[model samples]
Target: MSRPESGAPTTTPPPTPPGESPAAPLPAAGPGPGAVAVPPSPCLSKVELRVSCRALLDRDALSKSDPCVMLLMQSRGQWVEVERTEVIKRNLHPVFSKVFTIDYYFEEVQKLRFEVFDINSSSVPCGPREDDFLGAAECTLGQIVSHKKITKPLVLKHGKHAGKSTITIIAEELSGNNNYVELFFSARKLDDKDLFSKSDPFLEIHKLDDDDTFQLVHRSEVIKNNLNPVWAPFTISINSLCSCNYDRLIKDQPGVALWDRGASLGRDVPHADEDLASGPVDGCG
Candidate 1:
């Protein structure tokens, strides 16, 4: 098992985030879920949101529509704007790279809204006359996280149709712990598991618990058609990784049989052609 490299220069974490300063203190979304706001005394979790649109209305007559998305949250009848996505030019189907992070609590219901717009100029315009409207969607933060992903049709101000436009939202929860570990790893000379293509491989980080059990802490994204894969570096909280115990056993193995490990990094599991072997511990040995 590898320990997080220590004493590396790092920026100090902020004391507490400067949350939105609403005009007036809004009440908690009770009885019903509401806005760029979310849940209570509440169990806490951080959620990362990603948005994509498909078959959107093309507002521009000269070319494909230039589209952007605005995220709003409802707080007990008040709507607060949370974040806005970058405008994608000349494309009807655009997968935005912007990520929205929000606090989640288990006690209360949380609401969310997405407003997609077609930008006509440098400055963003609003209202029906401005005619920049494309489509909008509303749902609860709980719903999106429960489904892990959701797709809903964009609607006009009052549930009116905005053509065939639709939006897809994906949600991922982050570890809530403070201490973290950063890892960078790669592998070479992996076995070829596919007949027509190169192997697709990734890595998994598992923590050995006090009960003599292993729990998965992290998994790298798959890199396809490559035997020599240099996976991207990732940061994981030490609490989730091993309860802040570096000496605790960690499994940083390639996706393969545990016996073969470092030498057999190939494909992921559940596939017909799974990884041929496993990988190394400690580091990129």
Candidate 2:
């Protein structure tokens, strides 16, 4: 090739082939080497949970703990109990055969809690409060679904046996179905505590919260001068009702409370008693 003057322009590259086009340019480099790549979590439909305990603190004075597991889910800023396992008598290491089924929403951060209690007397039906406290564990559903299985130690921190024992957790995902519930309730022969021999009464339904306190979920209209009252029918999603668990307790308070007024029951008006009867109906109809 002959030498060109310094002012002369350089030669252009050759054109593309007849059928093929020019190669596209590569993209610019991303962030520096410090940038890390994260894998996306899998979306799951449902999950199954199996609970087991080891070296759990025995609440009973003279016998091994009859341990049972209770599962709770967080919803609406409150943790609601959903399921429970039957007590395994006198076994420090109890493998609950009862598998709990819960719907897993990948988009939502579903928080879960587990509590173990020691049953002193299996002959009688008692609430969690009556049962002896053993220990508890907490985690999110996504954590289990992502890993497919998780085992964690349970921590005990209460009473004279505080820091005395601990437990473990095991979880797995499974198929699930959409759950719903229809509820009906009625009261009979409610005591009339008013001075006029008749009282305005309404029903207040409460669901148990994580703090072992009852949170009001629903309320019925006030029925005037009626000893017997029937509430209107209603339907609710299982998640909203009790996180799809039926073993949880649903509390009902039936009485009249004058909030705006100065007088109130058990406060200014001395002690008084009232009896109300209520139960769930068989079906939505």
Any idea how many clashes model 1 has?
11
Best by lDDT: 1
Q: Give me the overall lDDT of model 2.
A: 0.58
Residue 102, model 1: Cα distance from true site in angstroms: 0.3
Give the 10-residue window scoring lowest on summed lDDT in candidate 2. Answer: 254-263
Error of 2 at 186 (Å): 47
TM-scores of the models, in the order given? 0.49, 0.43
Clashing pairs in 2: none
What's the alpha carbon RMSD for model 1? 20.2
RMSD (Å) of each candidate, 1 decimal: 20.2, 15.1
* Model 2 per-residue lDDT tens digits across residues 44-114: 66566656677887677776667778899988989899998766666787656456778877788899988
lDDT of 1 by residue, 7-92 (tens): 43334443554784434333433354443344235688887787889999988777767778999999889889988876666678
